[model samples]
Target chain A: MRFRVFVSLKPTVLDPQGQTICRALNGMGHNSITDVRQGKYFDISLAEGVAREQAMREIEQIAQDVLANPVIEEYQVELLEE
Target chain B: MRFRVFVSLKPTVLDPQGQTICRALNGMGHNSITDVRQGKYFDISLAEGVAREQAMREIEQIAQDVLANPVIEEYQVELLEE
Candidate 1:
């Protein structure tokens, strides 16, 4: 099994990195692009035959416990069978 | 319409930042986490009535031309209608 996790700042949260990149883009004359938010991706390979529901639960646990600050972030999980 | 662009390093490409994070995770005793990859997400708010296909095309152009190295990174675009 393989899992892909996407964690991002909640919409209400301020993203400084995204703002900086937006400013940089504007400075470089890329006006068409605007208001960017930044996030992180994680790809994990697990042993075969692990159920998607189980994996999701474990990943979500890992997320809330160690991977992210639940107060200001949200996450999505995708399970791929190998 | 709004566009969300996700740009990530190609699977074959080595991700130093992700590797560093993995090391940090291991050092912090999070041994269950493994094989991490890092990427960026952009949330763009576009004027209404733009077609999804058009938004995708422009985003891909921006990605290949300025936002990412096409040879090393891949991108996904999502159109959200408000």
Candidate 2:
């Protein structure tokens, strides 16, 4: 099984790195961009024979416990088709 | 207008950070995880009155020229509905 995990900062949090990117883009003349928030993602592959239900359960747990810092970040998981 | 941009290393590129994360997870007892590839994403908000076509054009350029290191990374852009 494979999953895509996206981890982003809570909307309320400040994102300096994203701001820097925005500034760089504007400087490059792509001024239409007003704001940018950067985040992390993971493409995860599991061992074969893992059941879908169990894969979902474990992937969610991995996302919540290992991939994200729940205090300021939120994560979403998407199971991929074979 | 808003867009989501995902940037990931080319499949052939080495991803040490993702490997470290995988090792950590395995060491922490989540042994089912076989591999992990990490990437970056951007949530971009554009100024009002920017047409969808232009937003798409400009966001793609920004992603291609600035957000991703095209030599080793690839990026995808998705227009988002408010």
Candidate 3:
């Protein structure tokens, strides 16, 4: 099975990369773009035989522990049907 | 209105950063993790008054022309209700 995870900075957190991109876009005349926040996306494939519940738990742990900065970022996980 | 965009490399393309993370995870004893692919996520806020359809079209164009490498990556855009 495959799971998709998105890790994003919290709304209160500053995103300099996102700001830089937004500025670049504005410079290019994309005035309609008001704000931009950047994040990370991950596609994870799990080996067979792992129970769904176990996978979810493990994924949550992996997401929090390895993929995202707990103090500044949040993560969402979704199982993808294959 | 807000939109979320995810840009990912096509499966045919190799992802070294993802591989490096996967290797690190495996080294940390997360053996159930089979494969990992990494990508970019963007949260875009569009200024008020742009029609949904126009926003969608402009977002598609921006995604293709600026946010992603069309030759190697694909992107998905979703509108988020505020």
For candidate 3, give the lDDT of residue A60. Answer: 92
Ten-residue stretch with the least lDDT total in model 1 chain B: B43-52
Q: Estimate each model's TM-score.
A: 0.75, 0.94, 0.94
The lDDT of each candidate is 0.73, 0.91, 0.91
Candidate 3's residue-wise lDDT over B1-82, tens digit each?
8999999999999999999988888899889998999999888998999889988998888999999998999999998864
Q: Write the per-residue lDDT of candidate 2 for residues B1-82, one digit (tens) a residue.
A: 8899999999999999999999998999989999999999999999999888878888888888888999999999998864
DockQ of every predicted complex? 0.46, 0.89, 0.89
List candidate 3 segments past 4 Å from native.
none
Q: Write the per-residue lDDT of candidate 1 for residues B1-78, one digit (tens) a residue.
A: 567777899989999988886787678765555667778777765445656677677666766776677999988877
Worst 10 residues of 3 chain A by lDDT: A73-82
TM-score of 2: 0.94
For candidate 3, write residues A1-82 as lDDT tens digits: 8999999999899999999989988898889999999999899998999999999988899999999999999999999854
Error of 2 at A75 (Å): 0.6
DockQ measured for candidate 2: 0.89
lDDT of 1 by residue, A8-72 (tens): 89989999988887787677765656677778767765555666677677777666666677999
**Which pairs in model 2 have colliding backbones?**
none
